[model samples]
Target: MTKTFETYSNIQSQNIRFRNRFGIEVAGDLYLPVGYETQKNPAIVVSGPFGAVKEQVSGLYAQEFAKNGFVALAFDPSFTGESGGAVRNVAEPVMFTEDYSAAVDYFGTLPYVDRERIGAQAICGLSGMALTAAGADTRIKAVATTSMYDMSKSMYLGYRNGYTDEQRAKLREHVSQQRWVDVDNGASETGHYSSGYHELGFNADGCIVTGESLFPEKLPEDADPVSKAFFDYYCTPRGYHERSINSTAAWTATTPMSFYEFPLCHNIKDISPRPVLFVTGENAHSRYHSEEAYEAANEPKELLIVPNADHVDLYDQKDKIPFDKLVAFFTENLK
Candidate 1:
């Protein structure tokens, strides 16, 4: 069945699978523009918004890129959607970053792709992974991100760097205790730690409780603006997909451990000489991430803010996305 939130008649799409360096099979949808076989094409690897599967916004981006004449591949990350991984619903930083390179590897083998012109585009949380991958993997000639998020920094420092040293210590202790619990239970615990950016899950009894659906059926009266916005997309027919983690479930209880330890996008300067583009909504709560990336990056980087748009707007809002700018960036740099 076609799982993507959007479909295009002008582009050809195929379900494809390839393995990452760890031998886990990653699933993706490859989109090719009309007459793709006639000539070589600059290819792009796309993924993101963290827990979302490829069928959501990533697929939309790929379809649009393909329609605009770039070969685009959007994939489910290592442990989500149709991708293969053990103990599903866990997020590992290193593995996630490697997934970008895996997509590049898949593109390199394609006869219709120009290997030297390959690029990557990530949305939300995966933006950090895209930048990290492009830094070390020179094969990714260019990179771009929309509504960028630095997951590592967020995990370690909390939203807007609100976590105090005491809170950080408490979080570490909680996760460490949870590890022992998992070892004894022979399975990973699952919970809703992401509900409130600052409210990490911890019951009165000190046990993590399973979270309600990530996408609530109805908006809570006191729901934060960000939560409400996310619900409008992930819970509604507009962006909901059965396979999306954000729509149906929660991550493993200790999924934050790796993100806390492994910093990402620290190599932003390494991507110098090779261009990078940071695109974010001017009103997005996550806009700081893109701004920080642009500041840390060396020459040949650009930061673009779409007026009056929020983080979720960039996910599937075609009119809000700067497609022309993205296409021009890749076209100018990938060549």
Candidate 2:
């Protein structure tokens, strides 16, 4: 069970649970305006910076939405956080996409939610997942994304478009071998989260692996921009949550196996007529992703870049989230 996190004073939230299509129970914190008494309210289901639980930035966004007169829900993806999973901290691209539609189903059933006015948003890795979900689920009448990364591209190609075809091939080979090893070891073995930077080592095969750092403890000022921004949020009191994957633990070793041939974002054009908003920091490392998605999407789409900001800045940086624009976009389209 998720303890309800604090948010805006005028926002009220409740911890709730619902079953996904697979009959797995998913946990969420649903937020509503303090005096909300209307029936059939516009709603949006929100999630992710990938590997994140509902307790972090997603909760902040959900509460913000509630304060602006929308029913908002933030949930843990399957196999993570308080959500049900046989093996914890695993990432399933397909199942994650399903979670959005499941959320829409839950919203439609609620008496105070406007079933036809439902929308969805994703932050970070879920950016691409929201695109896929909105394209496939018409119930999602509008779509929004912030500092988005296509999980598939990040998996095979690596961050910032690093990693060549040859490198990706080598990575795939290693992941497959790791998969077999896990199966041989009863498939109950878990892997640690991405070992942090400044830590360096190598495996028996000579492939570089992360190890504890011999350098003095890293300060946010000395770290790279992306790492610094994220660390300040996830590693400090600003945004840290015990259940967050990025904040504390690593994912299962075989989690990467799910993204081998994944190619999402091709169907983004299908979400036309319905308004779409793509928000990214002007300097976000993942900005190209939103640019490509914006070009692929139809006229109803708008891309808004936060000036002087980076990917992680939008995670919880109130000054950078553009709540006015978000409220306007959803209000106009979800009508």
Candidate 3:
């Protein structure tokens, strides 16, 4: 516990667990504002970057938000990190969407929390989940997302809209067939193409070895920039976590099977009367997602583009992330 506190000396926090709607125990670290629970303060819940655990960028944001006077909670999504669930490291969109609302449920019971003034924030793939939750759950009064990516879009349409209808049809066929093949397999099913990255370690020259070395000494220049950036963060001390699926395991084999059916961007306008702040890097590959979400939303919304930044930059690049904007947005709307 002391060791954990040493990692982030800027704030005070406590480990907590709460039961979700499914009665699963969700683990989190709640950052309390200075002076220790003296007031019923506005609170924020944070999560993100898809398979990332709370110990990484989410915790960074939570601790910073706490320093700025709002109590903040960062939790692992179900089936990931310390959160309780059957299978491990899988992305179930519906259940992941529910995790935010469940965090709200936990906040309501905290003596230091002003439940009426609650907000939520996320980054990358989880950003779309945060927006979807805020749209459906009125309890969330404001939503903020950085470096947003629509996971469903990534699954069905492929990165940057590169996949064709014919390719998608083949993908659907592949997933449907796997469902039958997995009936008796129990988390060990096959036929997934999450290939290319297998092993993770460090070489003699301190170069991070990710997978079977598609390139011997350096990453291929033609590799997807966003993925390369993710590797830079999760493969080094910048934001690595042993429990994070991004750091320790390859993308889930069944990721496409569950994610293709759930499009989180469908009802972006539903959260009106409630405010939203969408933040994305100017150079982010997923910036289009935040742009489309902002356009679809009703009034009382904002799209903040950080100059000279990329998708993963907002994850742990504290200097690059507009935390001031976040503090101001939550303060104004969560009042």
Query: Which is the leading candidate under TM-score?
Result: 1
Which candidate, 2 or 3, would have the higher lDDT against the true structure? 2
All models, RMSD in angstroms = 3.2, 3.7, 5.9
Tell me the deviation in Å of residue 32 in model 3: 0.7
lDDT of 1 by residue, 220-274 (tens): 8998999988888888888888888888787776787787788999898999899
Candidate 3: global Cα-lDDT?
Answer: 0.79
- lDDT string, candidate 3, 1-335, tens digits: 11111245667878899888887788999998886568889999999878788888888889989998998999999988999976666687888889999999999998989889999998788988888899899999999998988888876776676766666776776656655545646544443333222212234664433342222234567866755887788766676677877776755444566677778867778889899999999998888888888998998899999999988888877789999999999999888
Ranking by TM-score: 1, 2, 3
| Cα lDDT, model 1, residue 170 | 75
Higher-lDDT candidate among 1 and 3? 1
Per-candidate local distance difference test? 0.86, 0.79, 0.79
TM-score on alpha carbons, each prediction = 0.93, 0.89, 0.87
Q: Candidate 3 regions off by >4 Å?
A: 1-10, 184-222
Work out how many backbone clashes candidate 3 has.
Answer: 1
**Candidate 2 lDDT over residue span 24-59, tens digit each:** 899998999765675668998999988888988788
